[model samples]
Target: MAKYLILIYGDERRWDAETEPERAAKGAAHEAFRRAAGEGLLGGHELEPASTATTLRSATGTAPTPTDGPFLETKEALGGYYVVEAPDLDAVLALAARLPELASGHGGVEVRPIVEHG
Candidate 1:
């Protein structure tokens, strides 16, 4: 099986402003996804807001520099991710389509196969 990473992106401001019920709904949706993924869900996590992020950059001939925040400033930020083992890209895409972020229309998911080193 090939391993794929499912990256979840969303607008932090909108997510923070969500009402309790709306937040709960999103949580439920995630729960549903978790159940559906089952054994296919190798690992996953919800990240803290982008504001809490720290980034590191390295120069061609210098030590790495540390910065406080995401690498890029964008309306949408990576909010979470999941690592799953699937037969192929098609299989992972099918599972990604069920992500709640797609339903919200505020963000989307990206699936990329993990490169294996033999």
Candidate 2:
């Protein structure tokens, strides 16, 4: 089986402003998606708001510099991720197409295969 990382990106502003009921509904939807993924879902989790994120930059001769917030400022930021096991890219794409964020125009999913090293 091939391992893939499904990165979920969305507008952190919209996510943070969501009401309690809206958050609950989203949670329920994720639960349903988890069930649908079944054995293909190896692991996944929601992330803290992007405001809490920190970025690091390194120079060849100096220590890494730490900065608050994401590396890139955009309408959407990475919100969460799922590690999945699938037979092929088609299956993974099908799964990603069902993501709630995409349906709502919040953001979209990025599917990338995991590289194995030994």
Candidate 3:
């Protein structure tokens, strides 16, 4: 089996404006996804808002510099992620398609396999 990382990206401002009921519905969807993913769901988590992110940069010969926000300015930001074990890319995509992001049309999932070291 291979491990895949499913990165969730979204517009943070829209997410922030969501009402309590909308948020609850999203949570319920996640619960359903978790149940359906079953053993394939290795781990998952929702990240803190992008405003809380700390980015780091290192110059060729300088110590790493810490920054207060995401490294790039974009409409979409990484909002959360999940790591799962699957037999192939098809299986991973099938599971990723069930994530709430794609259903909401606000965001989508990027699926990539993990590189394993012998």
Candidate 4:
């Protein structure tokens, strides 16, 4: 099986404003996804808000400079991710399409193959 990384992007502002019940609903959805994925689910995590993020950048010959926030300014910020092992891209895509973020209509998923180094 091949491995894929599923990146979940969403509106941080909206997510922050969600009520406790709303958050619980979304969490339950994620649990359902985990159950569906079963053996195919490798690993996953939900991140803290982008405000807590630190970005580090370095030039070819300079020391790395740390910034206070995300690497880019955008309406959507990465909220979570899942790494899964699947038979192929199609199989992974099918799994990704079931993500709660997509159903919420405030987010989207990106799937990328993990490069294997020998």
Candidate 5:
């Protein structure tokens, strides 16, 4: 089985401004997605803190420089991810397409293969 990392993105501003019920509904949708995708899931995912982001850059012979925010300052940032196994890209897409509508337009989800570590 091939493993894929599904990264979920969205508008932080919009998410921050959502009502309690709307937030809860989106949470429920994510849970449902996890349950449905669990049949082929290799691992679970997480939701990152908005203010916890730190950026880094290459420093000249010293160390990687650290910055304050996400690598990109776009309204959309990586909100969460899922790791799942499938036979092929088509199977992966089928799962990726199942993401919630609220998660759409805000940003989007990205699917990529996982590199096996020794």
Candidate 6:
């Protein structure tokens, strides 16, 4: 089995714009995923904070620095992610499609494989 990271990207700002019902729905979605994930339906996962993140880089500009917020300028950022062990990317994509948080609305989900380091 291959380990993949299901990155959930979206407009964090829009979360504030969502109505009460919308927020509730999102919460419910999260709960559902948690339950499923615990049951081996989902391998392992985590939900990160909003797009406003800290990015640091070297002072000499050797590497991009992280400060109070994200390095990239975009409406949708890497808000959260899920780590799952699946057969392949397609299997992960199928899981991605089922995520309401990444469903049609704010942004899209990105499927990527993880590299192990000794």
Best model number under TM-score: 1
> What lDDT does each candidate get?
0.92, 0.88, 0.89, 0.92, 0.80, 0.71
Runs in model 1 lying further than 4 Å from the true structure: none
Residues 1-51 of candidate 2: C-alpha lDDT, one tens digit per residue = 899999999888888888999888888878887887899899998898888
lDDT of 6 by residue, 88-117 (tens): 777668767777766648878888888978
Assess candidate 4 and give its TM-score to the true structure.
0.94
Better model by lDDT: candidate 2 vs candidate 6: 2
Model 2 clash count equals 0
Q: Give the range of the ten consecutive residues with the poorest summed lDDT in model 1.
A: 29-38
Better of 4 and 5 by TM-score: 4
Model 1: pairs clashing at backbone N, Cα or C within 3 Å: none
TM-score of each: 0.95, 0.91, 0.94, 0.94, 0.84, 0.75
Per-residue lDDT of candidate 1, residues 62-97 (tens digit): 999999999988999999999999989998998889
Candidate 3 weakest lDDT stretch, 10 residues: 97-106
After superposing candidate 2 on the true structure, give the runs of residues whose Cα lies further than 4 Å from its correct spot. Answer: none
| Per-model C-alpha RMSD | 0.9, 1.4, 1.0, 1.0, 2.1, 3.2
Error of 6 at 82 (Å): 0.8
How many clashes (backbone atoms < 3 Å, residues ≥3 apart in a chain or on different chains) does model 6 have? 8
lDDT of 4 at 118: 86
Please estimate how well model 6 matches the true structure, expressed as its whole-model Cα lDDT. Answer: 0.71
Query: How do the residues 4-102 of candidate 4 rate in per-residue lDDT, one tens digit apiece?
Result: 999999999888898999899889988988888899899999999999999999999999999999998999999999999999999999888888789
Residue lDDT tens for model 5, 1-118: 8899998888777777888998788778878877877778877666765568887898588889898777766767788888999999898888888777444567688999999887
